[model samples]
Target chain A: QKEVEQDPGPLSVPEGAIVSLNCTYSNSAFQYFMWYRQYSRKGPELLMYTYSSGNKEDGRFTAQVDKSSKYISLFIRDSQPSDSATYLCAIGGTYKYIFGTGTRLKVLA
Target chain B: EAGVTQFPSHSVIEKGQTVTLRCDPISGHDNLYWYRRVMGKEIKFLLHFVKESKQDESGMPNNRFLAERTGGTYSTLKVQPAELEDSGVYFCASSQAPGSEETQYFGPGTRLLVL
Candidate 1:
């Protein structure tokens, strides 16, 4: 089984909608949960990072980690057209990083 | 204050040909990593380096791939006699701190196509 799993979504949402992205993992040792945003033809950039199983709010974005369920999520409030990008969840470790198949999001104007 | 930078933003080579990709990590970053993502696949780790030394390379697929980080400043990944399966986007990342929680900054990957 893969260590990290995420839906490969081409999820579309209207402008001003709320967008939710999520991932599930099997490793209990994972301590850091991170979300990265990747635009077409560009590298992924860190958007949200959490070290605990709680919610972290940053502007219009919120990252939640549920260690007991081994699940994590990123929520975008009032999504905009400029928010179109691929959201990737990464599990960080000392030796390697396991990345989820990103969910491609498009916010229509 | 530059983020990681990768050379040859894109590459196309005939099967069995050799290709070399380069990465310049963020200055003073002691940890460097290499990853690849094939078409429709998630990005996968290739190797990790710490100050000119390879800390872990278990992700490297086979003998045709080689990576080197000289002086722990810049690194290079060379694929000799590359195969069709070697086509992918090669990404390099660096973290200033070696801790597991340190955020890693990634470079725009080198998209490789082996025909």
Candidate 2:
């Protein structure tokens, strides 16, 4: 199985809606989870980062990790058109990161 | 401070030709990484460099690919006799340290098309 898996979603939502992005991993060794936002023609930018399990919130974004299930998620509250982009989940080891096939999201105005 | 920067934002090369991609990491970052994303595939790690030394290169596809970081500054990845399957977006990232929790800043990426 691939180390990491994510839905390649072209998930569309209306503005002010809640958006949830998720990823699953098979490696139990991964300790750090990260979410990245990538716009068309640009590189992936670090959005949210969390170590181990639990939740980390920054402004309107929240990242959650469940080491027991090897699942991670990024929640965007009050989504805006500006949040329209590809969301990528990354599982980090000692020196490398395994990234998922990003989910493309579009928020309608 | 400036973020990571990659050169030749886009390149189109014929199969069996050669191409070199360059990356300049954020100043003082001790760790550098190279990743590639083929069409419709997930981004995959290629290698990691700590200063002028390669800390890990287990993800490199094969011998045709070569990466170097001289003077512990900018780094380069060269593909000799590139194949059609080599077409992909190459991303360069740098982190302040080698730990798993350190945030990695990525460049705008080099979009390569091997025709």
Candidate 3:
């Protein structure tokens, strides 16, 4: 099984809508969870990260991790056109870190 | 203090040719990583370097790929006889230390196209 699985969504939403992106992992050893945003022609930028099962809020972005279920999510509240980009979920195992197929989001103005 | 930076923002080369991509990590960072994203695929890890030493390189696709970090400074990735499947965006990242919780900062990435 792939270490991390994420829906490659070209999801479109109106501005000010709340967006939820998620990923699942089969590995139970993953302790670090992160959300990264990537713009066209640019590398992934760290959005928010959580160490364990819980929700972390940073401005309009919220990252939640459920280690028990091996699930993680990134919630964007009041999303704007500037939030239009690819969102990637990453998890770190003991030996290495793995990334998911990013979800492309377009917040239409 | 600059974030990670990569050179040759875009490169288009014919197959079987050689290409070298460079990366300058954040100053004072001890941990550097190389990643690649093929067309329509997720970004994948290539290797990890600790200072001038290679900490882990199991993600390298094959023997045609080589990476180096000299003097614990900048790093380079060289692909000899590049293939069509090798076309992808190459990303370089770095962190202060492997143990630290600080997130890895990424470069703008080098977009490589092999024809």
User: Cα lDDT of all candidates, in order?
Assistant: 0.94, 0.95, 0.91
When 1 and 3 are scored with lDDT, the better candidate is: 1
Cα displacement (angstroms), candidate 2, residue A105, comes to 0.5
lDDT of 2 at B110: 100
* i-RMSD of model 2 (Å, 1 decimal): 0.9
Candidate 3 local Cα displacement, residue B3, angstroms: 0.6
Identify the candidate with maximal DockQ: 2
By DockQ, highest first, what's the ranking? 2, 1, 3
How well does each candidate superpose onto the true structure, as a TM-score? 0.98, 0.98, 0.97
Runs of candidate 2 with Cα error greater than 4 angstroms are none
Give the 10-residue window scoring lowest on summed lDDT in candidate 1 chain B.
B95-104
- What would the per-residue lDDT of candidate 2 be over residues B1-115, giving only the tens digit for each residue? 9999999999999999999999999999989999999999999999999999998899999998999999999999999989999999999999987867698899999999999
Error of 3 at A87 (Å): 0.3
CA lDDT, candidate 3, residue B114:
99
- State the weakest 10-residue window (summed lDDT) of model 2 chain A: A46-55
Clashing pairs in 2: none
Docking tier of model 3: it is: medium
Top of the candidates by lDDT? 2
All candidates: interface RMSD: 1.3, 0.9, 2.0
What is candidate 1's TM-score for chain B alone?
A: 0.97
